[model samples]
Every structure is written in structure tokens, then in C-alpha cells.
Target: MALLDLDPRAVATARRLAERAAAPVIDLARRHTTVSLERATLRLAGITGADHTHRAGDVPWVNRVVDTVRAHCGLDHGAALPVFHALAEHGLGTLTDLAEATAAGQVQYRVPTGADAARAEGSARAAIARGLRAVDRNRADRDRLVADLGDPPRRPWLYLIVATGDIDEDVVQAANAARAGADVIAVIRSTGQSLLDYVPEGATHHGFAGTYATEENFRIMRAAMDEVSREVGRYIRVTNYASGLCMSEIAVLAGLRRLDMMLNDSMYGILFRDINPVRTFVDQRFSRQIHARAGIIINTGEDNYLTTDDAVDAAHTVTVSQLLNERFAHEAGLGDHLLGLGHAFEIDPALPDSFRLELAHALLARELFPDAPLKWMPPTKHMTGDVFNGYLLNGFFNLAGALTGQSILLVGMMTEAVATPFLSDRDLALRNVRHVLDAAGGLAEDFRPAPGGLIVKRAHQVLGEAVDLLARIADDGLLNAIAEGTFGLMKRPADQGRGADGVIAKAEGYRNPATDLLDTGGDQ
Candidate 1:
């Protein structure tokens, strides 16, 4: 029973336009490869750790291997073959030994021909199979744990963030959050860690604003969440960013560590972090493939758009981006069940009918991707350090989530603009959400709008505008529309952003066994 009476033909048109808009970008992603994608392949091929002896920070083994292979024969033919060739036939003792030898200029990497190429491909496939098995084990562990424990109490699960700039502190905070009614805990990555090309190694405690999203950090938090899950008698989900320059690499690590959800948007790196469009598209496809195979739900970053652009004015852009994201995710084998498409309750509270408008937009998204576990975000851009009013605003946000049947509610804190939330702040936020949701648990069942009322009209208008925007984007191409500031009021050219240098056109016989295995749902 949808609250708004949306037109079915209009919805079909919007989806068709969205698919058309994403086709060119998806084609481009298919024909290109980025260094992060190669690094992800190496990571999936059982490569791990870093060689910090060569530099100040961790130079990951994947980087060392990919860089050596790229320097020797370029990655157009893929790094797996040459890398495996060195290890399999050359008798390189281990990946570490190969990394050391390559870094010391003692090894020459080349694409083998004939039987050697076959052997290298076979070995690469085998190594990647081992990595996939690890991912599979983690996925199975999550299922078994959830079956042994229990699921969340409601549809809109409470989501929280823990970012103390220390992995140990984050673990404590995450445990406390889960105990205090948070169903999903996202460990926010350190500020600016996204711009780095290499994934950090080991556990890190000294990040500027958040914890480093290292593999060790992921493992540590997973352990904590598991403990908290047992205590709460419900499975606790852990989330982290699989965005940035090393998007696919982080996705591999997240899968390896059994993360339940990841912040993975196709255009977030391009629009927000200034990563190259080609690089982001190439990397995101591979990352989403891994997420699909690992059974990790992906939460897109459409909510961040409203932070920079007016929520009401840019509401249709949110719809357009969601449609585009859905298409891209589907192309990578992600089902609607795994698409946690994001939107927010960020309307300015000063407007005469702001709450009504927010309802329209939220319900529009709910109706558009009904099967998706929509990640409804709370207000951040409009928080003016008014704790009292902020708390009220969050209540309204929670009400919207309940009324619209949002799947995941990122609980809003009152002291958002004041500082990092204290434990009390988080507790209060949880209380606010629990109250609204409890009081209005079945609100959506009875919440019906008039056939031509304000809410219904507004939703239709937004959908019409979204279809128009998608048609324009389809005509101009998604990249050019992005360059023309069609989203978030930011312009990122195709050839200009960070990581532009890492994008490469695929050559003949390019082979990535990880993609092959993931495409088959890791059965190989």
C-alpha cells in the first residue's frame, strides 16, 4: 500500500531514461581499468601487508606487485598473469619475497607466452580462488551467527557511526553503540584517507579525525561487533567506506573481514573527492562486483548531495542519481536486496511546508526502489548548534523514516554541529528514534495521501523532473552532465581529477580472474 499514488508509466519512463543515462558510463567502465582495480585483483589473489622499509608509510604488497608489473609490461593485459608468472614458474618463494625482489630491482616481470601464460593464468585463478574461499567463509560465518542469534527488531534498523581516531577506542564506542540500540555500526574512516592511493597496513591508532580503515582495524571491529551481537541477542552489522582511490582494495578487505555494509557510490569519489571520472567508474564496478559476491549491501552516498545543494531544489537529482546507481549496481550483479540506495531528511526547517516536502521526497524514494534497503540519512547541513531544536528536528526525521518505511535509519544527534557526539548524545539519539518508531510503527500502513494532494503532487513533480533530468543526462552522456554540474553543484571533468593517471585502456587478452570468479558468484 503506497502512500502516494504514483503513475506506473512515469516510473517506467524514469527507469528507462536512467538506464540510457548510465549505459555510456557503464560501457566506459567495462573497457577501462584503474590501478585500484588491479590492486584489488592482487589483494583477491592473496596479496597482503606493506613494505614500509622503502618509505615512511605502508607501501602495500599489491602496490609493489602492480607497480612492478606496470613498469615492466603495463597493466593493460592485467597484473595477475605477470605477477603469478614470477611466483609460479620463477620459484619466487612468496608474495613478500616477490615484492622485495621487485622493490630491490632484482626481478623482471613480463607477460609469458604459450604454455607459460596458461600456467600463470591457472596459478592466478587458484590464488584468487583461495581469497574467494576466505570471503566465502566469512559470509557463511555471518549467516550462521545471525541464525544462531537473531535479526533486528524492526524494518528501519538503527545505524550509528563511531569515529574516535583510534581503533581500540572505536571498538569500545562501537560496542557501546550496539548495546545502546544501534543495529549497524559504521567506523568512519580517517579524514583524507580516501585521497591516498594505497590501503594502510595493520592497525592504526593515530588518525586525525577518525580511525584508519586498515584491514586490521576491520578485523578488530568485527570481533567487537560479534561480541556485542551475542550480548544483545541480535546480529550487529559493521560498515566502512569502500570509496576513494582504493575503493576496490577496501572492498576486498571488507569482504575478507566480513563487513555487512559498505559506503560505495559510483560517482562519490568523482564528485566529492575529485577522483578521476574514469578511475572512479572503473574502480567502482570492480568494487561492486566484489560486494555482490561477498553478499555485502552497498549504501550509496546520495545523501551527501543535499549537504551542498538545497535538498528541495536538488531532490530530483537525488532521484536521478539513485536510478543511475541502481543501474550500475545491477550491471555488477548486485540484486535489489543488496542496493541500500541513500537519500536524506535534509529539507530546511524554515520553509512553510518543509516537513510535507521531505515526506514527498522520502516517500518518492521508497516507492521508486521499494525492494532496496534504502539508507535514510538524517540532517547534518542544517544543524545550527541548537541542540534543543536539533533534537526536535531529529524526531521529525525519525518520524519520516517510520512513515515511509525506511530500511536503515542513520540516527541523528542533537550536538552534531557542536562537536563529536558524547556517549550521552548517542544514547539520547537512540531514545528519540526508539520513541518515534515505537509510537508510529504502523504509521505507513494507515498513512494515505489524497489522490491529488500536496504530498502526491510534490512526489509526482519530483518524479517528472527526475525523468527530465535523466533524459538530458542520457543525451549529454553522464560524464558531460557531471562536468556541467548536474549533481552536488560540483564540476569534475573526465580527464582532470586525482587518480587520472591510473586509468588505463584494456589491451588485447586482458585477463582478471577475480572478475571471472566473482561473475560466477565465486563458484570457481
Candidate 2:
């Protein structure tokens, strides 16, 4: 039901440009492994716990293993082969034992060469097989639980965020949100946690804006959601951040916990958090691989671009980024169903024909990636302190979502810019969404643009603009374009960012068990 007939050549050109833009970055990702990648490998080998000797705070065992392996084996052959080889040869009972031994300065790692490489590879494969089995079980459990409980009541599953800064409090809020009609609950990570090189080890009580995204928090919230799922007769899905410096490591934990969705964008950290471009690209590849194996849908961050740039002028940037994100996700082996591509309704309401333009953008996204579970974001950039106007704006946002056929809709709060939403605020928000959805849900079934109308003109205009921008990106290179402030109006150089030090080129013979496993189709 495309109201505007978008140029097929323009779509094809945009895709080709996106592919060209991503090819070098993908090649670079294949040739390097970051410290986070090494840490994720340690995690997959079943390393857990933290070192208690440091006063700054206990360092994760994965960090210790990665540090030790980097110090001894040089990281070219990856941490897995050396760590697993030590486990096999020293008869270490577990990966934690090896970490403890290394910390005690009693163990030395060797980068196997020649015939010794085969033995190391054999050991690493067996350990990874065990880890993959665990992942498979988690995915199977999620399916079985959803099957027993039943799916959400309708399409465009209502998504709500819980940011209480306390895990226990978040659990209560999450349960309430589920009962209040939220189909998915995303536990927002604490402020600045993305910049942290290491994941916090346990459940944390005090955070500034949101709860710490630790494995214990994930476990506790998941258990509460499971209970609520049975009570509500619907499987309440869990979501958490799998972005930032520790992206790959978070993906490992999220997979183990069976999280249903992850905020896993290709360049979100680079554009918003000033993480190094190369580091984020490499990390996202590994993270998406884990997400793909875990059956987790990855919601990208295209909506954030609209916050920093004008929505009407930058709508094409969203489309361009989606194409790049889609390419990158495909490179990581993610199917369309798992690509939760994000867009938003952030255009200024004062603009004439704003509703028509909104529909054009949403419908264009819907038709372009018909199978993707597009995550439609609510209005935020223009929210004033007036709750009544905010509520009305949200009504329009909800109507657009219903008419455009969004797969997931984040409910907007009337008090968005005023304060952190209260439970009552969330309840009102859900009610607003339900009202619009119930009234206008069938509008899309019969919707069609007036021939050569403003909506049809706008969709084609945006697509043409996107194709032009993608061509420029392909010519200039994505890193250079990003450095020139092309996406979010912020210039972050490729070599200068928060996590630049973590990026490292892979040495010859570099081997990651997870990558090897994924390449060989070991995990399904």
C-alpha cells in the first residue's frame, strides 16, 4: 500500500551506495579484534566473577584474562586459543581457575604455533561448543515460554522504559508496566555506563538515571517478567543495552539471560557517545553475531539523529542510516525479522502538512523493509512543559504509528520534558496509545495517497535525497563523512574518541572461537 511510488532505481542506488560505504569498514572489522572482543571470548568460555585485590573496585575475570592474554600472546591469535590451551594443559578446572592462576602470576599463556596449534584449536572448539549449547538452550527456552504464555495482544507491541536507578524498584515498575499494557520492558542503563570499559559485576543499588546493566539485574528482572508473563497471559519481552565500549560482552550476558531485544546499533556509540568509529564497528559486528545466535532483535538508533538534526531536513539521513545498518546487520548474519530498525515522529508540528510528511516517512520505511520489525519512536524533541499539548501530540504520534503499520511503538509520555514519568503517567500514556490504536488501526488497510499529493511527493523527495547522500558517503567514505559531521551534526574523528585505545589490529593467525563457530554454522 505504498501511497507514493518510490523510484526503484533510487532504492537500488541507495542500497549499492550503502554496500560500498560499508565494505571497507566490514573488511576492517574482519581484520581486527578489540579488547572487548577478547573479553567476550573469555565470557563465552565460562569465565565469571571478579578480582577483589584492587581498591578501585574488583575487575572482572574476563578483563583479567584479556589483559593477561594480551600481555603474553599479543592478541593476534585471540584470547580463546591461549586460555583454553592453558585450561587443557594445566588441568585447570574452569576458566575462573585459569584467571585466578594468571592473577597470582603462577600461570603463563602461550600462543600455539605449528602442530601445537591443532591441540589448542581442538580444546577451544570443545569449550565453544559447550557455550553454544547454552546459548541454544536459552533461545529454545524463550520460544517455549512465549509459546506457553502467548504473544502480545496486537502488532506494534507497546514498549516502555524503566529507569528507576534501582534494580528492585525497576522490577516492580516493570511488572506494573506489563500489567498496564506494555508488551516489552527496556531497562535503561545508568548514565555514562556506556563509556565504562568493563561491565559492573553484580546488582547495583545506586545509579544516576537508570539501573546498572549487570547480569544479576538482567536475571532478576527476567525472573520477575516471567512471573508477570504468566499472570498477564502474555509473554512480556525484556530489552537492555548491548551498545557502547563493552557491547560484545553485554551481548554475551544478554544472550545467556535470553533477553528478547537489544539496543544494538551499528554507529550509535560513535555518533552519540564519541566512541571510536573503528572500535564501535568491530564491537558491533561481534555483538550482532551474538544477538543473531540468541534470537534477539536489534533496535538501531536512527531516531537519535533526529534529536540533533532537523527532522524534516534530516529524514533522509534516517533512511540512509537504516540502509547502512541493514547492510551491517546482514554482514553479521542477522535476518530481517531480527532487524528492529528505528525511526521516529519528531518533525515540528508547526510545519504545514506535518502529518502527511510523517506518514510519508513512516510508510516509506514500512515499504522499504517490509519484513523488519521497525521500532517506531515517540515524539520527544519538541515536547513542551504543557502536558495537554504533549498529550495531543502523542495522540498524533500514535495515530501515525497505527496508520503506518509500525511493528513496535514506544509510548510517549505527556510529562516527557517535565520529569521522569510516574506510574500514573505511564498508565495515561498507555491509555492514549490504546485509544488511537483501537480507533485508527484499520486506517492503514484502506489508506492511499491522493494522486500527486503532498504525501506522495514527500516520500519520493526523501528517497531521492537519501540516495544522493549515500552516494556522497560512498565516495567520501563513512569515516570521513562522520568526521565531517554528516549524521548527528557532531564531528568525531575516527582515531580520536573515548575507546580509541581499545582498538587493535588482528595479528596473523588471529582466531576467535565464536567467530569460527558462527562462520561454520555451528550455532543455529
Candidate 3:
């Protein structure tokens, strides 16, 4: 149980920052978010993307394509995907571009297959074509497997985390995860992996938390995991974070190498890690564009907010952040399926209605992102060194995930809140989820709300409070709102966060031949 003891102060600091970061963006993004091809095309044509001085980086182009496609396609995610593949080449310049595009026409797009689009190209048009045709073999496979799930399994799926120092060793661990019944496997990045400005090259053997996020590392892990999926005869999702100085590059690598999900958030870097808000936002905008085009699902870090704050009192903050994140993601051309919004069971279990409270929050998240996959995280805030208590908490968390019907259930470890989990520990965690789901698989089906059922009433209560908070955030500047600590107790100034300069404003002239190639014909 000593393995689960993490310093709570750092987590609390993150919560405070999350509040500051999300409050400002909720309303502004909802009101102004749009897709545009170029700045000059706005209705208020002469108005400014001024305060949004931060660059759109790859967003401008992605917005353009989605906008154009929307004009011609339908409103659903499936309708918009194909066009997204087309516009990703242009790259997104800013959120305004995306909002305008959304208002234009519905874009009809598809989940890209390598055969439809090409790879990176020499010309702009060619690059777009190439990126589309280059099929995401792995993604396609995963989607197929998920689609074929026919009926929900007897229980909720068990998701596991793997962070061995070596990719080869990690592969074995991943296989073991699949064999042990893990439905998803997330490869934790090495400590400080996000802070690196450029992506490291080659396979790595020494990682502090997990493994180096090299292209090779991504590819090797994905392939190994796929093998396990085949061996287990069940779909297995793979995950890695697309957050940091190299966000876009990491996304490009993830898509190229066939990753299933990415830990991609719009403001986490700035609020928690001191990464420049502008830089991270800019980087994230591009990465999400790539994610949209690649048909990759991105899990936002809202749950991480509670790691720092009281889960019960801060529940509204989590909901508010999810709203902001949802709007931001949609602006980037990502769809509901692509939004893996995060939440957790971190409230101290001391409260009489604690379990019901967790259920309310989880259900609220699920209802909001009805089409998206909600990622339910395990308890970290209250996990003591007692393994006995730890496992029981994990069981309750697992039950909560199933009852709330979370799409991605990140299993809680008996050794959580302390050191990284040992492989044996991971196995026990997996078994716990499997057992809960197997027994209670039909609980949701049997569930019916009373005139004012505790779960429904509490969930509604949180929503009403969130609506008020969101309205206030919408009126004040989103950035200013964040500074007021709207998310967790954490408060961060938009302009004051780290990595601002790391954001590239897409110099009046910018180009990447390799990126161009991938955009055009690299899919093959």
C-alpha cells in the first residue's frame, strides 16, 4: 500500500489551476467558436482575432476543410469526418476559423481508411489527399473490433496502464494485460516526457515513469498490443498522451504509428505544469486537428482537476471544465466519439452518500457527452496505504463506472496513490473490474429513476449549479474566469502560464515538406 502514497499538494495545485484555466473558455468558446478558412472571411470581416493573439497553428486549415465539408455534408460526426481529412492539410490558424466553418455548411466526412487518402505531399492539395489515403490500419482495426462487440460484454471492460522502462518489457506486460482481460492499455510516458521541446528518436530502455515517447516506442507498443488483441480475441485499445511542447508532432507520430487514444487536453499543460498557455493551446489546437483527421479519440484531463480538490465540492468544477473542453474540441474538428472526457471517484468516502455522489457526477458527464466516450478514473485522493481499503475503494469505483456506463473504465489499482503499479498489482486490478462488470452488467438496464431518485436528483443539482457558473464564466473573459479559480481550487492566469513562447504563430510563411507529404500521400 506504500506504493499508492503520492504527494497530495501537487495534485491540489493542479486542481486550482484547472479551475482558472477552464472557467474563462466555457462561454466564449461556446458563443464564438467556429470554423473559418481565412481571417478575412468573418461576418465581422474586419473584427480581430486580436485577444486571441495566440496562433491557430494548424487549426486554420483544419477548420477550413471542416467548414467546407460541413457546408456540403450533414451535421453528425460521421458526416463531418471525410471533409476533416480533406482540410487537415491547410492546418488550423485559430479557434475563430473553426467557429465560422461550423456555421457555414455541414461537412460530410468518413472515418478515413488508408485507401481513401494519400500520405504527406509536396503540394498543399496533394498533401491533403495523401494524408487521407494513408489508412490508419490500426485505428480501423480497433474501430472494427469495437463495432463488432455486438452486445455489451457481460461486464464493463477493464482498462490497464503499462509504463515499464523498456518498450520490449512493456510489450510483454501489454500482452499479459490482454491475457488477463484488459480492454484498454495506456503506456505512461517517462517522467518529464512532456517537457521536452522535440520528440526523442529511437527505442528507449530507460524511462522514469514509463517509456520514452519515441515514434519507435509508439509503433512497437501498438504492434505488441495488437498481437495481444488477436491472441485474446477481444478488442484492446492503446493510449498515450499527446500533450506537451511537441503535441502536434506526437499526434502525427501517433496517427502514423496507429495509436487508439491520446491524453490530449487544451489547457492542462499551462494550468498544472507551467507550460506556456499560449504555446500549449497552439500546440494542442494542431494536435486535435490531427486527431480529428486521424479519427483518433482524445481523453481530456478534467478528472485530474479533482486530484487536487475535494471531489464532492469541486464536482461542479469538473462539469464546467468538461463543457469548455467539449466546445474547444468541437472547434478543432473532433467529434463526440473523439472526446474521451475524464472524471474520477476521488471524494473522501467518509460522506454517507459518497457512492451516490460519485454516481451522480459520472452520470452527469455521460449525459453531457452522450455521443462521446467518458473515461472514469479510479480513486487517488482517498487511497490510503492500506491495500485492503485500497482494493475495496477500487471495487466501489469499478461499480460506479459500470453503473454510470463509462465508455472507458481506467481500473483503480490496490497500490494507487503511491508508486507505479507492479505488473502483479495491475493483474489484480484488472480482475476486480472484470468481476464487477460480469456480475452487474445488467444493472443499468434494470435501473429506473424514482420521482426524484437520489442519483438523478443529485446529478441534476450539479448541472443547475454548473449552468450558473458557466453563465458567469461566459460573461467574463474565459482567461480571466480561470484566474478566479472556477475549476478546482487551482487558479492560473492565461497569459501567466509557462510555454507561451513555445507556441509558433505560423509565421506569415511556414511549411513542412514532411508534414506536407503525410498530408498528401503518406497514408499508403
Candidate 4:
């Protein structure tokens, strides 16, 4: 009678997660924060480094157009998407000012819609006819540089990080990472940048551990990777966290700037950062909507749960989190391609058949979201300074990723627990991954779950347990459930944690014209 084999209890848990998300969704909508057209335009200018003084808000379409322009460009969060939408839509040669874009032009300055699929398609065809050459050109510029980027490919993706403290240093290291066979480059934000409600202006020179996640930083890194990606003859992804207070804003910025991936979790903040569960969920929904629109893949944070709990006993929790994340993303209009569901190889190696158990758990994720770019996480649980063991563990982690068919494999580093990786360390890690993958990359394909095997039985049993937990979460609120210690060995309350002030009700007078216009525009 059931639509799927998952127990009715799992359905119940999913329902509870949705219920917990409901109050926050409605509350955020009701708050209704408003920004003036002039101010929004000004903020937009700063994000893209446009030093123009144009005040065209007096025009009839000024206010309405500003709303659309600002939202598309991330004016609200003080980060501007690098797109000169006004110019692109109009085919104008310059963005000397935003006002010029809204002016009449030969190009269709107006956007197309669901009812006008043919019209949009026609317009797209025309643009491709003309601009296709340019896209190919710019893309070629990136591709040509790819060959110089050390054509090494790790079967599983390389796990990487960024330092907001210094851009030059970050760039040098990022380039080196690519040469060393890193498949992903994640620019860690300046310390506490996410906590700040407003984004900083201009190219930053100084940051703490990583460079500031500014528009310039994004552009700089994107351009850098294009060269590497082309050199390697494969796609190299750029990643940044789109969480915290400015989640929606960052997603918009990331999309417009051509960023490929983001760490955009549903309830990571409330569960870990203490962001109000209502605000986090609501913000996440809106942020993901933009990501879905921009064709950006999102990396969820379910793997963080195991860092605190017993990996063996709490394996089911990871599955539950993935299910919840998938449902939430689907509700937000994300497709399988946009899902980079997260899981880690963090179980202590000392446990019995830890490696085999990991394989079972991982393969289950691969099966669940077969079409998604599953992001297999690196080992963070026991990343002690013991570099030799850490490196071996990472090798094993890489083997799991390659075996299970994870699309976004994040390779672990031996120095994860000690410090940022040294250049030499990265080289060695790459070498390690290459050896295993070359020697045994196809190991998983040949191995099947043993008949009624311990690993298989435990995985199936854990999945059922996970479904039960999801059912409970559905009945209770996800926040209320989390407050009750539903995940991560730690218990955090919805209303009791920090960053509550950062959780603000939208001030009145905020108008999002794009939201209104796209309200009926099906997400796909």
C-alpha cells in the first residue's frame, strides 16, 4: 500500500521536519523588510566595483525595475553579482550606469516566462547565434589555461579549503592545489565574516585563515580555476559557504559570478551555529531557490552529525539527515543534479569492519541519490597530527568515494587536525590518491553486499532506524527535535542558542519585485 518501501514512520519524520520549517517560513514572509530603490542601487554598485553616480529612480519603471535589478544582483546583502543585467538584457556595450540597461534596445530587454517558452527559446537562439561565439571565446580562455594546471586526476575529489586572511597567499596555494590534483577549491571566509550581516566592499587584502568571500574574491578564484580546469581537461569546481544570516544574498551573488558549487545546508546553523531554526530554514529555502535557478550544486552538512555521535551506533542519523535535506531541496525546486548530499568517512578505523561498514553506508547514499552529485566527505573525526595514519585514512576514504561513485568526492588530508596543509603535504596526498585509484579504483564495482552479510544487514537495519527517526522528527518540529538532541552528540535549543539577534524579522517597506514576478514562475 505504501508508495515506497520506507516505513510509514520515516514518512512521519519527514513530516515533522517540514512542520518545524513551517513557522519560520511564514514568519520570514510576514516580517516584510523593505529597502529603498536608491539605497539598493547604491549597494549594488559597490558589490561590482562600479563607481558610477546614477540616480534614475525618478523614472516610472525605476522603483519596479530597481527591485528586480537589486534582487538579481544581490543588492540587499551588499554583494553584487558580476552580471551587468541591464546591459546583457539590452545588448548595450557598456554598464557605465545601471539605468542604461533598462532603456529600450534592439535586444529583448524583457525576460521571458513559462507562457512564452517559445519566445524565450527564440531569444535564446538569437543570443546563442551572436553570443555563443563570445561564450566559446571566454570559455576557451579558461580551457587553454587548463593544460598548464597539471593534468592529474584523482578518482575521488580532493577536499580543499581557503584562507580569508590573505588573497595573494590564498591564490598561490589554490593554484598549487590544482597542480597537485585538487578537484575542488573552497575559499574559507575571513574569521566571522558570515556573522556580519553586511558584506564588505572592494578587493580585500588581509584576512585571517582564508580570504574574504567577496565578489572580487569569487571572481579571482573562478578565473583561476577556469585555467586549471581546462589544463586538466576536466571540470574543477569552486565552492563557498552560503549559510548564516546572508544565505540568500550569497547564493544570488555566487550564481551571477559563475560559481559552480556551494555549502548550503538547511539547518546547520540552528543545529550548530545556534541560528534561530525558523530563520535558518526560511533563509535556506530562499537561498536554495536562487541556487536552483542558477544551476548551482549545493553541498549539505549532514556529515557534521557524526563528528559528535558514535559513528557506528549513530550511522542512521546521517541517512535521516540526507533524507531531510533531499526533501527540503525538492520543496525548494532543486533537481537531482543540484544535490551534493554530504556524508563523511569519519568512523573510527578501530571499530570492527569500519571500512566495510563505511562502504555499505556510502553505497546506500549513492543508491538513494543516484543522479545527484553526491559529496563524499573526508575524515575529520580522528584527523590527529599523526600524519602517517592520517594519510592512510585519507587513502581509504578516497577508495570509498571512488568505489561508491560519489560525484563530488572530498579527499581528506593527513594534517587536517594539526594545521593547514603544507604544499609538500598536498603533493603527497595527491600521490597517495593516484596510487590507490590507479591500482584499485574499480574495487567497489566487483564487490557486492555479502548475502545477509553483517555490513549489508547493519546498513539495511540502520536505514530503517533512520526512517523511524525521520518520522519522529516529522511529528515533533525539527528544531524542537534538535533541541532535544536529535543529532550531533550535542543538544541545542531553537530559541536558546546564540546569534538570535542576528535573526531579525524583516523590517517593513522591503519590496522584492523579482520574488513577486517569479512567484508563479515554476522553479524549473
The number of the candidate with the highest TM-score is: 1
Pairs in clash, predicted candidate 2: none
For model 2, how does the per-residue alpha-carbon lDDT over 1-524 read when each residue is reduced to its tens digit?
Answer: 65568788788888999999999999999998899988987787688899999788899988988888789867877888888778777898988888899889877898877767788887777777777778889999999998899999789999999998999999999999999899999999999999999999888889879998998998999999999999999999999999999999999999888899999999899999999999999999999989988899999999999999999999999999999999999989899999999999999999898999999999989988989999999999999989999999999999999988999999899999997656899999999999999988588888888778988888889999999999999998999999999997989899999888888898877877788897666845
Q: In lDDT terms, how accurate is model 3?
A: 0.64
Ranking by TM-score: 1, 2, 4, 3
Worst 10 residues of 1 by lDDT: 515-524
TM-score of 2: 0.98
The whole-model C-alpha lDDT of candidate 2 against the native structure comes to 0.91
After superposition, candidate 1 runs with Cα above 4 Å error = 522-524
Tens-place lDDT per residue, model 4, 1-524, is: 11113344544554455446444444553353222212222222322343233372223223333344444543332211222333445454533344444433222233333444344343323332332233224334434444445433544566577563777677788888877777788888777766655455456788877667766777788888777676666767789888876676566567656676889987787677766666666567767766666667899998988887888788888887787788778777789888999988988998878998888888777765668888888898888889989998988988887777777767566888887645777777778877777788567667666667876676667777776776677667666777888788667776665445434344232333334323434312
Candidate 1 lDDT by residue in tens digits, 80-173: 9999898876588778888888888888999888999999999889888999988888988989998999899788989998889999999999
The parts of candidate 2 lying over 4 Å away from their true place are none
TM-score-wise, the better of 3 and 4 is 4
**TM-score of model 4 (CA atoms):** 0.74
Q: Which ten residues in a row have the lowest lDDT in candidate 2?
A: 1-10
Q: Which candidate comes out best when scored by lDDT?
A: 1
User: What does candidate 3 score on TM?
Assistant: 0.73
**What TM-score, computed on C-alpha atoms, does each candidate reach?**
0.98, 0.98, 0.73, 0.74
lDDT of each: 0.91, 0.91, 0.64, 0.63
Q: How big is the positional error of residue 435 in model 3, measured in Å on the Cα after superposition?
A: 1.6
